[model samples]
Target: MEAGGWAAAYARLCREGGAEPQQSVVQQLRARAGAGLDLAARSLSRDTCGALGRLLRDAAPFPALALADCMLGDDGAKLLLHGLCSNTTVKSLDLKGNNLQAVGAEALGKLLQQNKSIQSLVLEWNSLGVWEEGFSLFCQGLSANRSLQRLDLRNNQINHEGAGELAAALKGNSSLQELDLRWNNVGLLGGRALLNCLHSNRTLRRLELAGNNVPSDILKAVEQAMDHNQDRQSILAENQSRTHVLSKEVLSLKEEKAKQFLNLMDTIDRQREEITRSSRQSSARVGQLQEALAERHSIVNSLKAKLQMAEAALALSEQKVHDLGELLSTAKQEQATMAERQAKDLQQQKQEAADREMKLLRDLSAANEKNLLLRNQVDELERRGKAQQDQLFQLKQDLTTTVADLRLRAVQAEERLDMEKRRFKQGLDDVESLRQKEVDHMTQHMEASERSMQERMQRLEAVRIGLEETGAESGQSCSACGTRPGGGGVNQSPEPGQAGGATAAGAPGGEATADDAVTRGGPGPLLAAEAGSRGGAGQGQPAEPAGGESSAAGGGAAAGPEQQGAGEGGRGEQGTRGAAGAGWAPAGRADSSGRAAGENCSPGAADESAVQQPPRGPAGQGGGDGRSPGEATDQGSRDLPDEGGGGTARQLPSERHSGLRAGVPAGHPQPQEVTRPRHLSLRRCYRTG
Candidate 1:
C-alpha cells in the first residue's frame, strides 16, 4: 500500500505542469521529495525548471533537493531555491557541479538563512570563487542557520582567504555536523584555522579537506576533532538525562521538607506559652530588686560627696606647691640673663677700643712715610740748584773770555785803520806832487793839458774812497766772525746791504748776531780756551795784543772765506741758522730731561717733540768741558713747568724773550729784540724749551 501511494504521488507531481500545482497533489508528492530528487545531467528548459520549483514548494514537507551536474546555471538554481523559503522538512540540498556561479550560490545562502529544517548542503564545483560576495554571503547565511548539520564544499575554488571566512562562520555554528572542503585551493593556513575551530566546536562531527594543498596533519586533526565532537555530543546527551533525573528528585525532597516545617511550627506554639508564664514570675522579683538597688544608690551618693571634699583639699595643696616652684625658677632665669647681658656689653666695648687703637697705628705709619718723602725731595732740589749755579758760572766765564777777545780785536782793527789812513794820505801827497811836476812839464812842453789833470785827480779820490770802504768791511768781518772749535766762523759780509744795511756802522750786524749765538751755545769750551790763554799770559810775561788779534782773525777766517765766497751776504741764511740753533740748546736740554724722566712720563711726548724739532748741526757739538749747551738748557727747562702737555710749553715770543733775557748775565750785550735782523720779529725758537 505504501509503494502504491508513493508511485501515485510521483505521477501526480509529474503531471502538474503549471507553476500553481493542486494542493492535494503537493501533499501526495511529499513522500517522493523526502526519498531524494536527483535532476543531474538533465537539459531542462527554463519554463520546465521554474515549474519544478513550484512543484517542490507546493509539496508542503519536501525533505531533499538534488540538481547536481544539470548545468542549471544561476537562474535555474535561484528558481528552485524559491521553493525552500521558511522550509522545515528539507534535510539535504545537493547542487554540486551545476554551474550555479556566484548568483546561484548567493541565492542558496539566503535560502539557508530562512530555512530551519536543512540538515545537509552539497555545493561542489559551483565556481563560488568567481565573486567574493557569494562565499561571504553564504558564510553569513550559515551563521544564521542553526538546523543545518552537514555541509559539502569540495572543489569549488575556495582559497585560503575564503576558507578562513568559512572557518570563522563555523565558530558560532553549533548544529553543523559535517563539512566537506576537499580538492579546493585552501592552503595550510585555512586548514589550520578550520582545525582549531573544530577543537571548540561541539556539534560538527565530520570535516573533509582531502586532496588540497593543506597538510595531512591538519586533516588528521580535523578527523580527531570530529570524533571528539561526537564523544562530547554523547556525553552531553547523558548529562541532559542525568539533569532531568536530578530535577525530579529535588522536587520530591522539597515536598518532604515542607511537612517537617509544619510539625516544627506546632511545637513552637507550646514552648511560647510556658515561656510567657515563667516571664510573669520573673517580672515580680525584678521589681523588688530594683527597690533595693535604689536604696544602695543613695548610700553611694553620700559617700561620694565626702570623697570629693577630700580630693579638693589635696588639689589645693598641690597647686600652691606648683606656684612656689614656678616663682623660684623665674627668679633664677632673671639672674642668669642679667649676668649674660652685662658680659656681652663689656666684650663689645673692648672690641671697639681695640679697633680704634689699630686705626691710630695705621695713621701714624702713613704720616711718617709722607714726611720722609718730603725730606728726600728737598735734598734733590738743593742738588739741582748747585748744579745750575755751576753751569751759570761756566757760562759767565765764557762770556768774559769772548769779551776780552772782542775788545782785543777791536783795538787791532783801530790801529790797522789808522795805518791805512796814514798810508792813503802819503799816497795822495805823492800823487799830487807828481801831478804838479807833470803839469809844469806839460805846460812848458805843450798847451791843452788842464782837463786831463782834473780828471786824474777825481779818479784818485774815487780810488781812495773805494780802498777805505773795502778795508772797513774786511776789519768788520774779521771782528764779528767768531771761530768754532772744529769748524768755521759765521760771516755775513758778502751782501750786508741785503739785511737793510745792518752793516751800516762798518760792522755786519747779522754776523754779530751769529757770533753771539755761537758764544752762547759753546760758551764753556771757548771760554776754557780763553781762560787758558789768559792764564798762560798771566803766568808768563804779558803777550803782544797785536799778535793775538792777527792769530784770532787768521784762525776764524779760514772757514769764513769759503762760506763767504758762496754768497755776498748770508744774513738770511744766518738768520735761519741762528733761529734753529737758538732752539737747539733748549731742545737739547729737553732731550736730556727726556732721557732722565722718560721712565716717569710717557715716551710718546718725547718722541713727538723729537719729530717736530729741526736736525742738529755743528751747534749741537759738545764744548771743551765735554758737555753740550743742550745739557744746561735741559737742566734749566726741567725746573720750569711745561705749562702744556706733550712735552711742549706754550709761551708768547715776547714772554720767551723776556724769560731768556732774564736768564742772561748783566755783562753780556743785550739785543733790543731777540729776533732775526731781516724782519725784526720776535720769533718763537723752540717749543720744547
Candidate 2:
C-alpha cells in the first residue's frame, strides 16, 4: 500500500471515531503519495519512516502503531521520532527488532523528553544498549517522561552498565509501572542495581530479569522488591480513591455550614429590629417619668422649709428648760457635800499633824546621831589625807633627786665622748704619718734598683761588641752575659709599693673599729643607770597607792571599836562619791602638781557635808545638794578615764560601790533607812559616773 491507501485508512478511522480528518494529516499523507512513499508497507525506507513521523506529528488518527522487524536504522529512527516529538494522538509506539543502535536509542530518548502522549514504548530485540552513552541518554529522557508507563527493552544486549542506567531512571520515573528486561545480559551486579532502585521507585510493579546471568539470591531479592512496589502502587491507588470520596464529603459539609450561617444571620437581623422598637418605647416612658418627678420634687422642697422652722423653735425652748433644772439640782447637791467634806478634812488634818510631829522628832534624833558620826569620819579622812600628802611630797623629792643624778651622768658621758673623739683623731694622724714614711722609703729603693739595672745592661752591651770582633766562639759567651743582666734586674726590683698601700688601708680600718668600740662602750652604762632610776621611780609611785590603801584598811581595823558608831555614816559618805573618788585616784597619783590633786579631792569634802544632812523627801533631797544624784553620777562618769588608761579604776557602779564599802565594820548594824537611800544614791551615782 502507498501513502494514498494510508490516507484513506486514516480517514476511515477518524470517521468511525466520529471525528473529522485533520487537514495537516491529510496534507502529510498527500505529500507521502507524491513522494511515492508507503507508510503501511512491511519494510520502511528512511523517507517512508520520515513521512510516517510527519503524519504522526499533526492529529494522526492512529493511537497504536507497530513497526517491528522493519530494519529502521539510526537515521530512520531519528526522522520518525523527530516527527513524533510533537505528536499527541499516538499513545503506543513499537520499534522492536529494528536494528536501532546507540544513535537511534538517543533519538528515542529525546522524543520521550518532548512527547507527553506516548504511554507505552517497545524497543525489544533492538541493539539499544550497544553503547552505555545512548542508554544513559535514554534513561535521562525516561526520568523526565511523565506520560510513559510501560517500557519493554527485552533482549537488547543490556549489561550491568545499561542495567544501572535503567535502575537510575526507574528511581526518578514515577509514571512507569511495568518494565520487561528479560533475556538480557544483566548479571548479578545489574540485578543488585535493579533491587536497590525498587526501594526508591514506588510506581514500578513488574521487573523481568529472566535469562540474564543473575545469581539466584539476587533474582529472589529482585522479586521481593518488585512485589513491594506492586503493594505500594495498590495502596496508593486505594488512598487516592478514599481521598476523592473525603473531598466530596468536605464540599457537601461546607455548603451545609454556609446555609446554617445564612439562617443565623437572618434570625439576628429580626431580633435587632425588635430590640430597636422596644428601645424607642422605653425612651418615651423615661421622658414621661422625668416630668412627673420634677413636679413632685418642687412640692417636697416647700414642705421641708416649713418643717425646719417648726423644729428649730421647739429645740430652743426644750434646751433652756433642761439647763435650768440641771443647774438647780447641782447647786443643792454642792451645799450638802461641802458641809460633810469640811468635817472630814478637819479630823484628817489633826491626825496628819500629830503623825508628822512624831516623825520629825524621831528623824531629828537620828539626824543628830548621824551628824556626829559624819563629823568624826571627816576628821579621820582629813588626817589620812594629810599623811598621804606628806608621802606624795616625799616621792616628789626623790623623783627630783633622781632626775638631777641622770642629768649629771649625761653631762659626764658627754665629757668622756669628747675625750674619746680626741684620742681617735690623734691615732688616725699617727697612722697617716707612718703610711707616708713607708711610701717614701719604697720609692727611694725603687730608684736605686733602676740605676743598677742600667749599669749592668751597659756592661753586657760592651761584651757583646767585643765578642763579635773576636769570632763565632765568643758569641756564646756574650749571649750568657746578656741573660745575666736581665736576671739581675728582675731579682733587684724593689718589693711592690702594694705593702705600703695595705698598711695605709689596714690602719684606717683599725681606727674606725676602735672609734666604734669607744662610742658603744662610752654611753652604755650611763643610759642603763638613767633607765634604772626612772623605772624605780615609776615602780615606787604605784606602790605608794597600794601601801596607802593597805594602811588605811589597817587604821580602820585598829580603830574599829572607836569608829563603830561612825562606820554607817562613813559608808554612806563613801558610797555617795565612790565613783568620783576612784576616777580621781589615778589623777591624784599622776598629778605632779599639787593644785590639781587638791582640786580633785575637794569634791570628797563636799560629799561628806552632803552625808551629814538629815534624810529628806525627794523634793528636799535635791535642794540639799543643789544637784540631783543623777547629775553627780553623770559628772563622775565624765571625769572617769577610759579602761585602757584607768586600769581597775574603770569599774561598774555595783563593783565600785562594793569595793568602797568593803572597809565598813562587818558587825556594825546597817539601818534600813540609812543604808537604802545611800545604796540607791550610790547606784545612781556610779551608773552615770
TM-score top scorer = 2
- Per-candidate alpha-carbon RMSD to the true structure: 33.3, 48.7
Error of 2 at 532 (Å): 99
Candidate 1 residue spans exceeding 4 A from truth: 1-35, 38-41, 244-689
Backbone collisions counted per model:
6, 1
Where does candidate 2 stray beyond 4 Å?
1-41, 59-61, 277-689
TM-score of each: 0.33, 0.36
Candidate 1 C-alpha lDDT tens digits along 1-689: 35345445445554665334333434434445446655556655554556566555644444666667777788877877876765566677888888878888798779878887878788888788656788888888887888888788888888888888888889878888778888888889889888877766788877788877888787787888888888988899899999999999888889888988988898899889989998998899899999989999999999899989989998998899899989989988998898899889988988998898889889888888998898889889888888899999998999999999999999999999999999999987877676555445434422232333334334533533443343334334324544222212222221222211100011111121111111111111121111112111211111111111111111111011010000011112112222111111222122211111111121111111111123222222211221234433322222333322222222222113221211111244432222212111101112121
Q: What is residue 286's positional error in candidate 1, in angstroms?
A: 45
